[model samples]
Target: MNLAEKIDKILANEVPFLEVAIYYLDFTVYFANLLFPLFLFLSVIWFTSKLANNTEIIAFLSSGVSYYRFLRPYMIGATIVCIGAFFLGMYLAPIASQGFNDFTYKHLKKGKKAYENTNVYRQLNENQYLYVGYFNVTEKTGTNFTLEEFDGPKMVNKISANRIQFNEADSTYTLFKYKERRVGEFGDELISEAKRDTIFDFDLDDLTPVKYIAETLNLNELNDFIAREKEKGSSYISRYEVVRYKRWSLPVSAYILTIIAVAVSSVKRRGGMGVNLAIGIAIGMVFIFFDKIFGTLAEQSDFSPFIATWAPNMVFAVLAIYLLRNAKR
Candidate 1:
């Protein structure tokens, strides 16, 4: 479906050739994280079923090989895949995620309003804080903007503007209907201006923050972001936490899915490879369904993000163990 959509865009000349190439590359990287485990599972089922049908597994058993011994090679292969997936999840996927989103908003969603978080609050530094009631990234403008400068627990200056526009060429901000207040030990002084142009310590990226900004950050950066969000009492911290925990959970799932696939297809059946593939697909769908449900629950409700990220893996791990035991017997 995704490829078809991109091809349609190409045929219609809706996106540039270079952008289409980058989009395909980014989508491949992003989907690899989701599809690799499923592909591995299906491959394991198919290969093992072939061996079973050929009596290779029975031959090995008759040669006094223990079931666990027979499983060593499969486990080793799963470990290699797990490591690769870990690397992708921790490093490459974040870069690809950012590229994918950038391309999407710039080309596919041209002239459409991107849903940016309204009423953003951020600590620019130890002594400065910023706020914006609403910001439009495409327009490079914000409404009801404010900047407060503090001096060791006391706000020394405050600047508020009805609207602020960012000048990309000059790297400055133009404030309309702006007000400034300076607090002194004795009293406060206020100044009003119909229009003002000044340099802000921040930039356009500060004004337009992405909701899934967490997804674009590597693990170390994500941890730092989540810590800062926690300090600020951010309500969306759960969403970031979900992305962080899923990085670990997804790689670990490769091992679980590998074992489940082997156990399910190691015995030759009357229906053969088709039956094994059908079973594998069904299991894969169930795992995805559970993952989506728990992830959505965590984002929408008060459910623990750690639990939500790991619940799918835990459930499948138990299933793997059960199947392994049966297969061994």
Candidate 2:
């Protein structure tokens, strides 16, 4: 087939069917990806135009046999940018997006879910702490919880309760259906059948800043949270650790995207730079959409975060390298 035929075939394949949401989504992301490169390419053109307008190009061409030689450095720079964006978008972007989106959707959005608002653990001191089974933000109540005092890694006292309610008005916690036991230097004793409102002097630190859960964290915060959670025997720490690693991998995408842009738009053709930019945008969008889709796959299943994040970079890096070599020749 001719070049036109091949190009047509590729575009046809890229254009998604009207009936498929995934296809439309892919198109949306692909188009979005194209915008960055188009801007970059235009900026290149703008600079080139400035040089040409100011007679700089003429000066260079007057001195040298070919003006194209001056473009070599720009091409090399673009290549470096491409590689940087590719790594950033392909790996680092996905990871950052995962954490960033979760933090945004979970906390920033209105109408917080009950489950999201529930459960809080706090540290009162080196050896004293509290736990709430559930904290209902709407009702300002927590149910089925415990308060414990540890003396040098040994439990000295345990307080168990069927329900604890936080009085938001006074910033205090009240225990209901409670039992308290002490086994310290004074020896074992029990206090039972407690009913009170605002009985605890403890500040609402146990439940304040209600959005302190694991999902609200970025990569570094997630790492710190995981370590703290591990010390407390939190089973969810492993999951957060996986997410933390993924976050660090996201910034590499900017490099990956830069490569794809440069590789595709660097060509000089009779059809003009516009066509090349359009093509670059179309291809970039597809890759971006794929990145997000792969991310969702990782979230929904046991997909390797590294593979899911880096696959687009790998594929596009190969493609960019091929295109760059072809353009150079």
lDDT string, candidate 1, 178-276, tens digits: 999999989999999999999987757666767769888998999998887676445678888999999999888989999999999998889988999
lDDT for predicted candidate 1 compared with the true structure:
0.88
Winning candidate number (lDDT):
1
Whole-model lDDT values for every prediction: 0.88, 0.57
Residue pairs in clash, model 1: none
With candidate 2 superimposed using the best TM-score fit, by how many Å does residue 199's alpha carbon deviate from the native? Answer: 9.0
How much is 158 displaced in model 2, in angstroms?
A: 6.3
Report residue 193 deviation for candidate 2 (angstroms).
Answer: 2.0
TM-score of each: 0.88, 0.51
Clashes of each: 0, 34
